[model samples]
Target: MALCLLSPGQGSQSPDMLARLAADPATAGTLATLAPLAGDEALRVAADPARCFANRHAQPLLCLYALAVGAALSAEGVEAALVAGYSVGELAAYGLAGALPAAAVLRAAAARAQAMDDCAPADSGMLAVRGVAIGEIEALAAAHGVDVAICNGDEHAVLAGPQCALDALATTLAAQRGAHVVSLPIGVPAHSRWLQPAVAPFAATLAALPWQRGALPVLAGVSAEPVRAPERAVETLSRQLAATIDWARVLDVAVEMGTTVFFEVGPGNALARMARERHPGLPARALADFASVAGAAAWLRRQLA
Candidate 1:
């Protein structure tokens, strides 16, 4: 049996997330180091639900949360056979795997958010569609001029574009039997072509950061491929900014690679839930489900055993 560590993206942060992590001794120091990197106003922003969901605040905070949990897990002597991050969480995965320093991941996340913000259209956003076929989703997105941002599976995908277009698409999809559509909290069109302008600048930011070989492999969100070298990491990381994320492929690759258990090292259990829904029978849990890191580690030990 093998363990795969997962880190969540935006839409996973909670108002009391910082407070919860602060109460954990194993993660406190890491949070302290990450809080400032997120911003001088990070703590305040985290406390306010309105501000925390903004791309500028959400990106760094999510990365910080993931890094803190990752550090806590490592302190407990838990090692991952693989690591995969969703959207912004990809940066934290690198930090957890030792490709970059924890501090550097926060910086990169901040820069990435800024880059995305620079190109984001005023009314752009994302919408999640479930219980629908990919072909229908693509056709609807094409008709509405939106783009498929992330493919979670054949029946689940995220679309991004103007708010009005997303609303139209959602209306159409919601009318269908067994279809569910929900607007995501993320304000920017993350993996859509609308984010193309953000790529070059973010690439420069990542290229400037110091990198080293990680202890474990990380699955690239843009593709289901393993990233072992710095150049590959840089390419996939920056390219994914405006490219479609094949998250379904990531999960399939993880299972094929012998991932018997999945652990989400962040505030919410969304990633874990997705893993369970997609692969049924695979054990998956999130850090937020446990009262302490040690408890999570113990659970992981049992699952792995």
Candidate 2:
């Protein structure tokens, strides 16, 4: 059997999310640790996903949710051969793969969030452009003074730019053939050169952090392959801020690495939807929005069985 792949990311969080999580004392306890990172009011704010998108709230919120799902899977004795993360979700993947303790992962997440927010000025923005060819999107970005923050697939690329540039780009995209754009709810532009100022300080913090040796193969978002050493992982994280995410290529490499079945472990069905559309026939499931604990656990167990 091939390994189960967990998709880590930030796009699908909501405030009513915890209401769906129910009263697992363990998960509740795990949720408690997020308070200090987000604030005593974190849980309340999480009831709406939009609130969590605030820079300070987003980092810790994503880390907490990722940890909650991973902890639940671990408690169920579920194991995968390899794991990978998208952007901020990489920290969660590292923790799940035993590359670092959960506490260390949380610290990294917090630091990363802070660094991005600190480095970004007040007027940058991100836009999700749908129905655009990769070539055309790149061309459009260049023509409009914007950067590709993430290449989700051939049709889906995120553009990051200052507000004025974003407005002009959106107008161009709307006028372009086969293009529609949606602005993202992010505090700062991510996965673009806009984050370059944050790279050095974030890297210095990561260098001081400790990482554990992993027992399972954990792949990289930058290289679309497994990382071999702790330092290598650190190096990737350092460059992450100033790099563009090649998600479609990453998915292809993951498929080649025996990820025949992908279970998106974060709060939204975003990755599952992406995989289904991208591959057409791949086996994929999104696990975070089930109606009940039994429903989710049963679904996962059935898949593994």
Candidate 3:
């Protein structure tokens, strides 16, 4: 196993989804321990699934979900050499990589969410644009006031800006060329300048909080590389507000490191799907469902056999 990459973060929570893990004593105990910070609402939101789509709720819940699943895998003697996370998932990545405690992760997540919510504007939102060339999207963004917030792949991306700009882009994408556009459930425009207001406060929170050097190599969503310093944590955390997310780079880097298996440790399988999209040759699977975990584990055992 050259690298067993574990991804933790938002947009993966589903209702009744974690019940299987909760039933497993090894997994449930860790989850039970996090109840105070995470709360029963995490399960309720996971059951609904859509609730996890909200940034305010998703941020912290995903942290707990990531910690729980990552903890379970470690309990099973599975070890990952490198770990990376996207957006809010970065905190969970930190915990799984032993850069922070589960409590600290949740606390940071909660504080971050509150800070983001407090600073986020009411009209701003994000949009997912698919099946378009990056150059075309880049050109479009330049033409409009929008920014390329997330580059999931060379062809797939998300543009963020004011509602008017996003709506105009949506029309343009459909009218000029055939492109799929969907409004992301997230309200605040993430990874765009629209979040500039939240950066400082969130950074201050991170700076005040104690963060240790990571035990395992931890890749950052801000630059798609390993973040090595405690101070860099605050900088990266703050950059999330005004930076573009290069998820494609994240996946490519892991593959280059000989990452044969990717475990998306959370309630949803979004990152795993992205892994398959970005690297079809490599095996990428989610640890969302127990059956999925068992299947991936068995496959890995065969590969490592």
Candidate 4:
């Protein structure tokens, strides 16, 4: 039974995320490694709605969630034939794949957040637009001086630009057939051209780091294929910071690679939901879906059997 491991990016985090994980013995070791890296106010900020969305807090915390959950699953003897991630979650994916250590992954996530925050203009953000075709969304965003940052599927995309432009675009799309627009919690415009300045510095950071090709096949989010060599990790990680995300392709590639099941190893169920919707025949569940990592691990083992 081939399985795919998923790591979610930002916008999926909540206050109780860590607190819940802390209760699970299966995940304690993973959390212990992450707690110090997350800073003293990590748990407090997660519980504080106003502070959780701040890039500095959101990025590392989300990555920690992914790494911790993935670590727990590994500790329970579960393994994935393929691994993938969304945005900053990709850093955690590398850790899951054994390409980087958990500490290095968290540090890289912090740097990523800082770099993106520095380049992001004040009052700029991302918006989720459902029921609009990607092509149409791109056209509308271009007209509003924004960019289509994420293409989740044909009719779902995330647009990024200045707050004013996003508002204007949202208003225009609100009256369209089947259109539903919602402002995201993020303040920085991620995965858009606006973050291009962060690429070079992040590239240098990744390049300077030591890496190893792990046992599992890790898919590159941008290319939706195996990143076979450690040498390519730096370029792959850096370029995706400012490029558009093609998550639909990532799912398609997972199926092509013989993934019979999926485990979304992170805070929310968004990635699992999307996978099930796109490929109903395959079973997918988020780590949060179970009472504990032990429960999730046990269930997955049964499913494989």
Instruction: Encode model 3's per-residue lDDT on 22-85: one tens digit a residue.
Output: 8766678887788568755777775665575777777887788788878877766677878888
Q: What is candidate 4's lDDT per residue for 26-142, written digit by digit as tens? A: 877778768788777777777788888789999889888888888888888898888989888888889888888878887888888888988988999999998878888888889
Which candidate leads the pack in lDDT? 1
Per-residue CA lDDT of model 2 for 169-280, tens digit only, reads: 8888888564788887775888888889998998888787777774566677766767748888888877877888777777787788777667777778887777777777
Alpha-carbon local distance difference test for all models:
0.91, 0.75, 0.77, 0.86
Error of 1 at 262 (Å): 0.2
Could you give me the TM-score of model 4 versus the true structure? 0.96
Query: What would the per-residue lDDT of candidate 1 be over residues 172-221, giving only the tens digit for each residue?
Result: 89986467999999889999999999999999999998998745899999
Best by TM-score: 1
Arrange candidates by lDDT, descending: 1, 4, 3, 2
Predicted structure 3, TM vs. truth: 0.91
* Candidate 1 Cα misplacement greater than 4 A, ranges: none
What's model 4's overall lDDT? 0.86
Clashing pairs in 3: 9-89, 12-268, 14-46, 15-46, 15-47, 16-47
What is the alpha-carbon lDDT of model 2 when measured against the actual structure? 0.75
Cα distance off (Å), candidate 1, residue 170: 0.6
lDDT of 4 at 288: 75
User: Which model is ahead, 3 or 4, in terms of lDDT?
Assistant: 4
